[model samples]
Target: MARIAVIGAGMGAMAAAARLAVAGHRVVVYERGETYGGAVRRFERDGFSFDTGPGLLTLPAVYRDLFVKTGKQPLEECVDLVQVDPSSRHVFPDGTEVALPNASRAGVVQALEAALGAGVGDRWGDFLVRAREAWDRTRRPLLEEPLWTDWQVLAEREPYPAVPHKRLLRTRRAGTLAEIAAWELRDPRLTALLDSHALAYGLDPRDVPASAAVLPYMEHAFGTWYVRGGIRELARAVYERCVARRVEFVFGAEVTRIVEKDGWAAGLELADGTVTEADHVVAGVDPGRLRGLTKHALDEDGDVFPDASAPSPGRFTVLLALRGAREAEAAHRTVVHTPDRGAELNWVSGEGPGPVRPTVTVLRPDDPALRPDEEHESVVLTATARPKGDWAADGSSKPFVEMMVHEAGAAIPGLRERILWQETRTPGHNGDETGAFCGGMPAPSLAGGKGYFLRPSNSTRLPGLYRVGGWSHPGGGLPHAGMSGALVAGLIVEGPGFRGSQ
Candidate 1:
């Protein structure tokens, strides 16, 4: 059996550890923090709890496969995975509200039409049909398998089939998401709805390729989910699975460097001046930090290296401890669209001070585990923001936090008066939890933008070294991170010929 050393106790790392252990490898995980789960953290105060990371789960089949491969106990047995009906309720800037049902195309179409006018639903439904084509075309190479050697093929070609349009004697097709919204949807509210999907992932819809249609398609196809307690419980389940598989975990053992011997990834060096050798090393870390941990160039010439020039966007969140009970019919998730899309996009692009009102997402789960009693409620308000925002300063993020509460007032009844307490989190806090640069969240790798959006390959230039996490192949988000683990494990257990789960 090969001795495997994993860096970090993040979900991706633990997923890989469990699979490798079941494959008869002696796996040891070294995490810098005192606990596992990386960004999947929880905050509690006065008997209230809040998930500081992702609030919902999409594409849960990824985790289901993880549990199925690792042990006899499936994912459902470990955690209460509930489907969120009306996947989300959107409140547009123009005061139009629509609650889209989860994984129901016909229902979503009917609801959109009812709320957005006569023909709006058909346009959205048609767009989704096209989006499904994009998903089917890229799902295998992008998510289920390791990033291909000729990944540029996936990058250079746009998988999203854009409708042809004649403009000023030129017959062209929508290339960017902005073009799709303008040309196809042709409604301002529709544009806002389309942009919100990209914004949710901290992506700029204006520049992201048309292939990004897959994002919404994935959600519509698989449905959105919520763990019974919080997303933290999902992390707990994965960690437990790792332990059940006999994976050794060393918490608070910060890895200083990736030890190299004879041009291969030999092992890990801890911060305490101690070293442990392994036959293989799997690094589940940010690309920027990984580069610093190794002297050897992790990516060779012509490899897709993680982009460092443009900083990924981060999230600003406010946890609200409210005095009243949550309304019975309240949507589990609500997105309040920004009035000014251009200004919000400009702020996210780091070109401006930020919009007076940004798009806000408010999550209010009905679970009693999050509240102090039947009379109280716990709510979380979040917005995508610049990664380097000076949130550490006293009241630096107060204006934005207050704006979020103001916007959420549109969704929640008596929102401003219901607050009993509040706790805010910045990208700086995310950086502290996940060691990600600027606590910025990485978007899933896309198949267009001339390969600019693709992440680095799992197998680095260094032999016996692999990367597994949101920062690597398949890119970010919960499902992608889990898929990255499966890919890495397949590569290690089945050799370089591993094409991914068949």
Candidate 2:
């Protein structure tokens, strides 16, 4: 069995470690922080707890498969997986509100029709049909399999089947998501609904490829989920699973370098000046951090190593502790759509300072574990922001936080008055805690623009080096990060000829 060295104890890295250990390989995970989860962290004060990372899980089957493969109990047995009903509630700029049902196409259609108009629901339903086509065409390549050597094929081809539209004498299909919204959905609320999916991942909807439609499709198809305590509970379960499988972990053991022997990865050098040799090395951190450890320039193909100049978007979160219990009828998640989409988009994409009113996602889970008792509640508000800029120094996020709380007033009555205390998490905090570059949060891989959605490949120029994580192949999000782990383990245990998970 090969001795494998994994960098970081993030979800992706631990997933790979668990699988490799089950395959009979000796795996050791080294993390700089004291905890196992990377960004999937939680904060607790005076019996109030909050999940600082992703609040919900989509495509939980990814983790379910991991648990089934690595241990006897399934994911549900490890953690309480609850389906969040009314998947989400959207508040539109025009004072229109729609509560979409979880994983039900007919229900979503009915809700949209009841709130918007007669033809609006049908238009969205048709768009979902087309989005399904995109998902079918790209799922295997983008998620189920490792990136191809001729990845240029994916980049050159657009998987989304844009609807044929006739404009006078010309028949044109949408190339960008904005074009699809303008040409197909015709309503401003529908446009905001469509663009919100892309914006949540930090992609500029105006320029992102039409394949991004699959983003919403994935959510609607798989449904959203929540763990009993918080998402941090899921991370704890995975970490425990790795331990059960004999995967060793060393916390506060920061890696300083990736030693190479004759152009192959030899081992890792730790911050304490200890060198641990291994037969293969798997890196699960950001591309920039990986490069720093190796001290080598990555291949120029740009498939495995993305452009460093364009940092991925980071999250700005506000955690609130409230004095009252959550209402029984409240939806688990609420999206407050901004009135001016253009200004929000421009600011998030780094083109502007962001508008006074920005789109905000408010999460209020009814789980009693997050608060001291049923009489209290914990709420989280988050918005997408660029990795750069001084969020703390300029006091920019302060106003945005106020705006978000004001908009969230639609969901929670007397929200400002109900707050017992508040805490804000910025990009800088993310960078420090998770070691992400500029505290950027990577988005999931997409198909279009000659591989614009493609992340760095799993394999690198070095023979024994591999990458597995949100910053690697298949990209970010809880489910995608887990998939990255599976792909990397497959490549290592089954060899380079390994196509993908069965």
Candidate 3:
């Protein structure tokens, strides 16, 4: 049995603990934050709860399967998950609105055509086919492979040259997401709608590879989903599973230095000066955070390490708890776009000031939630990347927050009618909350030109150490991070698996 320690208590970290404990390893998780679910967590702000991280769930089976493997029933955990109908509401600049259905490809396309005009449906179909092919071919191998070595070591030796899925990242990469959309639609309106991945990947859609166009296709194909209470409930469920298996969680404990003994990893040093010895260490923190905190752990060659930080193409956010609400019939699952907008203004940081504009995305409070009637609601809005220089001081400034709220209010009618509670978050705040240096979600933008393998793998710079979470292979998102945890566990269960396991 391996004595394992995970460095964060986020979704990825929780998933790692659940898998490792089930595998019979002695696992301990260290979380610098007071609560778990680092990014996707919730807090009671004025008697109302808000989902801070990813607002919804898609491809939920990825989550169910993890619990099933641990012999636990998912429903037993908090938050019952229900399939959503009419997946989301997508609006265009022309004021045309379309409601996408859940699990119906034809319906979504029909909606798209109605909103964006004709021919767009056919183009969506093409992207869907490609996305299906990518998913079918990609799932089995990498999801099932145990990537346990230090990636930085591999980089030092020449970037461990093995492609995980059959599809090649280099060869399959194609036109930019924006350019691909432009090829299909007429008005730049539709193109802008499709080009929004700029923030998703921390890239400019013009530069992001076309292969990423698969994301929308995947959404249309698989359908959008959510847990009964909130997305963070999933984290709570995973935490429960880990507890059942006796995984030790080191909450509010930060790892300061990694102890390397003669090449292989021996243990780690916590911020409090306590030393813990372990046969293995699976890093669930962002690779940047790990690298920054454990500087002493690097090998001479600097094999497994995080890529340098880069700016995500967009970001701006506002959340509100509605005291007086509406039924919100127009919004079902995902609310793609709304009326509000703030074209890049200036971003002013310590050096003083700079310019950056960001695209904004607003999610209406799902109507069927805990509201006794239609009047109470919860809402969150997120925008594409904006340079840090835009907001004076931090995002906490009343002026900055007010500006964001005003912009959101303008975008969605009646937004100001019932603001029970509210708050705003900036890219800088995100960088501080989670160690995501780029201030994007988990994955970096492929359009920005960072090498594909440049993302750290499950391996560490020193031997016997591995990494997992949004920073590693398979990229970020709930499903991807969970898969990373499983991959890490499987590697420890049996060193990188036997030949036949592949």
Candidate 4:
């Protein structure tokens, strides 16, 4: 059995450990934190609990596959996975509201037409048709398999089949997502709906390629899910699965260095000067921290290098302990569109001040486990924001918190009056929880950005070193990170020629 050292007990790292252990490898994971789950954390106060990380799960098949590969118990047997009906309710700036059905194209189209206008549903339906084309073309390379060596092809090719538009004498096809919104959707509400999907993942709709249509397409195709207790329950199930597989975990043991021997990743050096040698190492860290842990070059020329110091988008969250019970028919998730799109976009991009009325996503799950009783409710509000030190430390978060509460009022009745208590978490809290650079969230890798959107390969320049996480090849999001673990395990177990999970 090979001795493998996995860094960080994040979901990805644990995912890899479980697979490697099941494959007969002696896997040891070193984490600096007191517990597992990385960003998938929970906060509780006064008998109320809240999920501080991702509120919903998309593409749960990824975890289902992980459970099947690593253990006898299926994922469904581990967690109470509930499909969130009317997947989401969107409140447009023009006072229009629409609740889209979960994973049903016909239902979504019908709802859009009913709320937006007569033919607006047809426009969105048409967009989904083209988005599905993009998903089909890139899903295998981007999700089901390891990233290709010639990843530049993914960067150069536009998988989204854009509709041709004639502007006077010149005919052009949409390129960026903003262009798709303007040229094809042709409605401000439709544009806002499209932008919200990208924004939720910390990607800028104006900057992302038109292929990002796959964002909404993913939700529509796979359906949004909620665990009974919280998303952290999913993490607990995975961590328990790892333990059951006999994978060793060393919590509170910070890995200070990636020890190298004969130019290969030999093992790990902890904060206490203890060294554990292994046959291989899997780093589940952001690029910046990975670079700091070793002196060796981890990537080759032309590989995607994410600047750790560069300002990346982070999430501002407000956990509300409300005094009243949740309405019986309330939509689980509601997105309140920003009043000023330009101001909100500029704020997240770090080009302008914070929006007076930022776009806020309000999550009010019906699960009683999060509240003290049926009379009390737990609500979570999140918005994309700049992950800068000053924003967190300069006392600016208070106003932003107020802004979020004000906007969430559109979704929740008497939001401010009903709040019994509130806790605000900034990028600072995220950095503490996940150890991500500046606490910035990483968006999923996309095609057609000159390979700029693609993350580095799982196998590093170092022979025995590999990366597995949101910052690595195939990129971020729960499903993609889980897939990274599979790819890394495949490469280590089956040699460099290993393609990916079948």
Off by over 4 Å in 1: 166-171
Instruction: Tell me the lDDT of model 1 at 498.
Output: 94
Worst ten in a row by lDDT for model 1: 302-311
lDDT of 2 at 250: 92
Evaluate candidate 4 by giving its C-alpha RMSD to the native, one decimal.
1.3
Of 1 and 2, the candidate ahead on lDDT is 1
RMSD of each: 1.5, 1.4, 5.9, 1.3
**Residue runs of model 4 more than 4 Å from their true location after superposition:** 166-171
How far residue 128's Cα lies from its native spot in candidate 3, in Å, is 1.8
Query: Which residue runs does candidate 3 get wrong by more than 4 Å?
Result: 75-78, 140-173, 295-306, 311-315, 333-358, 367-374, 387-391, 394-411, 438-440, 444-450, 498-502
lDDT of each: 0.90, 0.89, 0.61, 0.89
- TM-scores of all predicted structures: 0.98, 0.98, 0.83, 0.98
Off by over 4 Å in 2: 166-171, 300-305
Tens digits of per-residue lDDT for model 2 on 1-502? 9999999999999999999999999999989999988899999998999999999999999999999999999999999999999999999988889999999888899999999999999999999999999999999999999998888888878877746656555556678899999989999998988998888888888988888999999999999999999999999999999999999999999899999998889999999999999999999887878878876655554553357556778888889999988899998999999988888888887788654587889999999899999989999998887667467777687887788788888888789889999999887788888888778888888888667778988888888999998988899899999999999999998899999977
Error of 3 at 452 (Å): 3.9
Candidate 4 C-alpha lDDT tens digits along 291-359: 889999977886654666675788889999999889999999999999899888887887887645889
Which is the leading candidate under lDDT? 1
Model 2: clashing residue pairs? Answer: 155-450, 155-451, 304-456, 304-457
Clashes of 3: 26
Number of clashing residue pairs, candidate 4: 0
Model 3 poorest 10 in a row by lDDT: 154-163
